[model samples]
Target chain A: MGAEREPERGAERVVVGDKRKLRLATASLAGCFGCHMSLLDIDERLFELVERVDFDRSPLTDIKHCGACDIGLIEGGICNAENVHVLREFRSHCKVLIAVGACAVNGGLPAQRNHLDLGQCLQEIYLTAPDIVGGKIPNDPELPLPLDKVHPIHEIVRIDYFIPGCPPSGDAIWKFLTDLLDGRTPRLGHPLLHFD
Target chain B: MTQPSILLDGLPVPFVDGQTIMDAAMAADIFIPHLCHHPEFKPQGSCKLCTVKANGRYVSACTLPARDGMEVENNSPDLNDKRRTLLQMLFVEGNHFCPSCEKSGNCMLQALAYELEMLSPHFDQFYPNRAVDASHPEVLLDFNRCILCELCVRASRDVDRKSVFSLSGRGIDKHLIVNAESGRLADTDFSWADKAAHVCPVGVILKKRSGFAVPIGKRRYDVEPIGMQVERLAARSADEES
Candidate 1:
């Protein structure tokens, strides 16, 4: 509402003035870096995103562990305390919270480890996989956090949108951003978003 | 697609809604060359070979939504040139060793390439160093022959919701990555019963032991092509579901 006007042609986009530039932020928890990398998939179009929205605390651009903003894009699953705190803060601050990849949307890849007991998976990956880190973190704790089960972002807070994909394709990301910034509801595009 | 549509080289053709101009032309006995757009999978416009002139713009008939008064040209001289170039793009991009391929007799890509009379790939080979992960207890992978139409990715991710497969890398470096870590599908939770091994449009992904079970020159699809395979598969799917 900050002096943003109707788009010159479409119902959205400001024709003039400060353009009510939406304050935005993004973060990740415990999934593959693939989701964040998908943002880079935009190649050159990412410049348009920088111009349209203000990224206040993205892991890529910002140093602050957390911040208040309008749009919070959380990529990765919740398997630790840091994930919980960051997710809650984003939920409280952002006007719209988007679970921005498959892991965030429906407990993607990391959750694949759910098939076995947490202890067993830890022992298998560390003690069993070809190369063992062997208490690599030393005093540091392992994932699965013992007694608690891994959960998706929606389980912890209300999510306004879900952009699914192992990592969603760049075109899907572009469409969603265009739709949201333009105040139009977005439909999930490309069957990949629905894919694992 | 409501009326008997426009010319296919001056021949009158019929069309129906919820179908493409290619379908309409095919119904009127006109032939068009396309590699990736089997009537089975969702209309992937990746190949752009099935592209036809609709109201003077080059649009892929397989994926375009038809409208009234749309003038479609299926076999104009310019369109044939466009299609031949697109087919050549596919032909040169991958290792389509037709002499050694199993689906040679029934493959849509090979059949279309032959129909276009393409004798040699016009460009340099990509020669991607992809390892064949025949790791699935039931399925096989020959990464050399993959065209990345994403049919297997869709069938697994969308239909089965298994997400057992994915595409890694991008552009020229892009290739299929299955399961998770080992890149071995059997290491993940894929089962023999999953239909992903059945619907792959190319010979890249195959049903391992099931290969040649139907025998050469006698496979059910040898004479019928994919349109009928889809119809029969749909019926089989419904029967299995019930």
Candidate 2:
């Protein structure tokens, strides 16, 4: 895909090998991955997307860790230490970092726990539930420790752009990417900015 | 008699003598972003989202009366940046978790943030621990989502003639207080029929048992933005005039 000649600049159709496919990295921190699904909802446009960009560390490519990349699209809020580390890594590796979806931008649903004690919350879900036989809040060293409150990605690192929605609509994502690729600042307006 | 005019973003907007800049803009199908100014109620100018440059000076459009030949800038980059900062402050000052909120799709605050392209909350989340008042049998008051627009305060006092709601405290500590001696909605005579019950633009004053009935994607602001309806109304009036 990288070897393919870039799209002709204008009507002259000049071959430019200097323009390589932009590398993109994506990650799901504490979200449901609905934004990733929305990206896929671009449907046949995914073909066009692949022609213009390559995935580095993303669920699509199954790449474990991000290397140097031009763009990083992060979905979800920071709910644990692992999210903070992953976010920091993305910030260091990517030239442009985007907070995609409500979770990444504003802590969304997971932040409902911000009002309650984290330990009490775990107790209700694990130890105190009536249906549980021997349920316990996992204290395994492998598990990441939960933060006191859910935090949006911007609160932890610099986000160059944001795509707002529970999961931003396919059209909104498409417009944003195309605008960015075309070297235009993406602006979400009527019909594209629905919160649901 | 010809209606008076105000130059909003350089476009002439015709309005009655008593109408503010916001009212004139709405009358002309131009949306001036606002939260505290409702057409059916007196303008409060508290939220300040509708602030615009009038004659090169900033003024709340909701309260500033329109005058003939007055120039107002509503959509400039500088004004929008200011509005965005104010919105960010509102977001961090309250617990506005839109995904889990029953008012998620319908919330004016969420819709305004989306309309303004607010990239993020852009500040540390205060995560204020406010309590919910479920004492009223038919209404629920969740203090977490209040932006202090005071729509309910005005509605209860002016429209319902009940005076059941009022703003208390000051600055960051300020909040909505029930009028009853017990400081509970149940202690007050706030009912389903009260104007206050329907005035809140956020999830603060929700009618019990009617939540999620319209579904997530089908709510009022979900289908169209908060100001679109007013714009449509303006368009209809324009059509009538033409």
Give i-RMS (Å) per prediction.
19.4, 1.8
* Candidate 2 chain B, poorest ten consecutive residues by summed lDDT: B233-242
DockQ, all models:
0.01, 0.61
Pairs of residues at least 3 apart in sequence or in different chains that clash in candidate 2 = none
Q: Enumerate residue pairs that collide in model 1.
A: A7-A12, A7-A13, A103-A108
TM-scores, all candidates, are 0.47, 0.89
Off by over 4 Å in 1: A1-196, B1-18, B23-31, B212-242
User: What CAPRI class is candidate 1?
Assistant: incorrect
lDDT of 2 at A102: 87
User: Residue B53 of candidate 1: its Cα lDDT?
Assistant: 83
Tens-digit lDDT track for model 1 on A67-159? 667788889878778788888988988889988775675555555445457777666766777866554322355542432456677778888
lDDT of 2 at A24: 95
Q: Against the unseen true structure, what C-alpha lDDT does each candidate score?
A: 0.65, 0.84
What are the RMSDs of all candidates, in order? Answer: 17.6, 5.1
